[model samples]
Target: MSRLVDAHCHLDFSVFAADRAGVFERAREAGVESFLVPGTTRARWPDVVAMGAREDVAVCLGLHPCFMDAHDDLGDIAALSEWLDRHPEVVAIGECGLDARFADSWHAQWSLLEAQLRLARARRLPLVLHCVHANDVLARRLRQLAPPAGGLIHGFAGSPEQAMAFYRLGFVLGLGGATTYPRAQRLRRTVAALPDDGYVLETDSPDMPLAGHQGERNEPARVAEVCRIVAELREQTESRVAADSTATACRLFALD
Candidate 1:
């Protein structure tokens, strides 16, 4: 069986509240051996940690840019940093980045994002970025900050040029359910063009459900289907996609 990894997901969200354990079970049955759950706010850290404590999961902690308005105090940043120092299960520092598509407050987004970037740098942890219509700005900041250990650009839907840019920064492109859509021509083209070692696969489960699975909540079990699509696009076997992407994830997050 192909051993795959969902490099980024939010299993801590309420969407999976009813059957979170069952979700992981199905994923294992589908040959998806591991997954990463990223925290979107300070309050979710405990739950994120709890989920990661499970046998085959890892956790990433940081404030997502889309939820910048949720944080009332900067002390949360300090708390996250302290938590990172204390937890070996904390694999990276993110779910953070600029999101110009959703909100108009560019300044506020940058402030929160840059602060998290600094925290990731300080802890020497990989970042799991969430850029939406802001790849240029994200690339610029990545160049400037140059975090010692780079991370994954989760849900990547940018141009091949943009993919090359992030790849140069030691960042891996995270291809997920979006690429499974028949109309995601540009994304498919980007995936086809990317080097085998340039990305890690993900499901972004309970959100970004695959094309045929639209309207149905996603789960990590569908990650293998994602690998199949990516492999077909790249003219490679599913096992090759799964193995390479899993290795990329392990190397990026320092997973054993």
Candidate 2:
């Protein structure tokens, strides 16, 4: 089988602190060779960057829209820019975007998201964006802001049309545990119809567990199952799906 890449997983999060090494070991054992871990807040950037020391780990730093409390009105964005400058090896700028769940902070989310978008644009880095209940709004924002280095829309469960909108904007969808569920018809259809370069496999570790593993902490190792289901959805061989998705991830994140 071709090696797989978990394009989005929070291995740096505290949930994996006790056995992070074991997590990586199992992932590699399961044929997952690389991971992209995105930082969700200023407080976590150090841990996120530190994970990059591992040969198989790549990092992206940005203040997530869900954690506005962890961000400052001025310093965080500037600090993120400086951090990226200091850590030139950092792969992208995000884990950032709008979330409707935090609607009260909607404007603030847009402010922070736009700031990160600008940073990614200025640096010519790809972004690992997160959007919830705002694809139309986000598509509009991307069109207007025009950040050129397309990124992944992590944990994408949007419609096929929505997926294509992001693809047209240079972004690819991160298909994760959600696709493993039989009831996720919309996402499955999106997966089936995705352009050759339109999507990548992800686990969103410790959060989006696969169908049979509900309530279990997800890990990078589970991405192999994601690949399996994706292959089934696309009516392609598992190795083909794994190879194509891994290649797309390498190209998107500039991984070696």
Candidate 3:
């Protein structure tokens, strides 16, 4: 089978710090040769950049809403801009978006998201967005902006229509561990029905472990399982899912 991209992960995070190199090796052997590690806060950008420097890893720079306190001032935008300008290796503009499911500061989250969204558009980079319980606003903003560089809505768990909203606006859904759950009929159905190019496989590694691996640390290698599940849901073969999802991610991130 052709190699696949673990479209979203946090290998730089402490969870994999002890054996980061080993983690990549295992993933590579599992047929996941490329990885996209997105920044979650200013403090971790350096580590993320260092990881991105590797031949097989790509990175995205942005502040996630769950860590709203990390982006105190709008200064993060300036810093991210400078970093992105200096680092052609940076592939996308996010890991940023609203997290109404967990964060109490929804307004602050939206404000921060807007700043990054504008930066992403200005730089002509697709965004690696993370939205939880806030698709209405996310879709609305994207409609207004119409960014030329499309992106992935990572860890997608929405309906077919909701998934189509992003697809129509040049964004594709990221399918991950959630699809492995038997109870995730809705999400699985969405992945199965969406246009073949409208979704990509992600592990969201060091988090979102598959159903059987619950309570364990997720790694890029597990994305292969995600691909399998997506294939099963779509009633297609594993190889087909791998090739299609990889091509879609390559286009969105300019990973040529």
For model 1 the TM-score comes to 0.97
Show pairs that collide, candidate 2. Answer: none
TM-scores of the candidates are 0.97, 0.99, 0.98
Compared with the true structure, model 3 gives a TM-score of: 0.98
lDDT of 3 by residue, 159-242 (tens): 998999999999999999999999998997898889989988999989999999989999999998888888888999999999
Which one wins by lDDT: 1 or 3?
3
Question: What does the lDDT read for residue 197 in candidate 2?
Answer: 82
- Superposing all C-alpha atoms, what RMSD in Å does each candidate have to the true structure? 1.2, 0.7, 0.9
lDDT per model vs. reference: 0.88, 0.93, 0.90
lDDT of 1 by residue, 85-182 (tens): 78877988888888887667678878888888888888788899999999988899899989989999999999999999999999999999999888
Model 1 stretches astray by more than 4 angstroms: none
How well does candidate 3 score on lDDT at residue 217? 94
Task: State the TM-score for model 2.
Answer: 0.99
**CA lDDT, candidate 3, residue 178:** 95
Q: Which candidate gets the maximum lDDT versus the true structure?
A: 2
lDDT, candidate 2, equals: 0.93
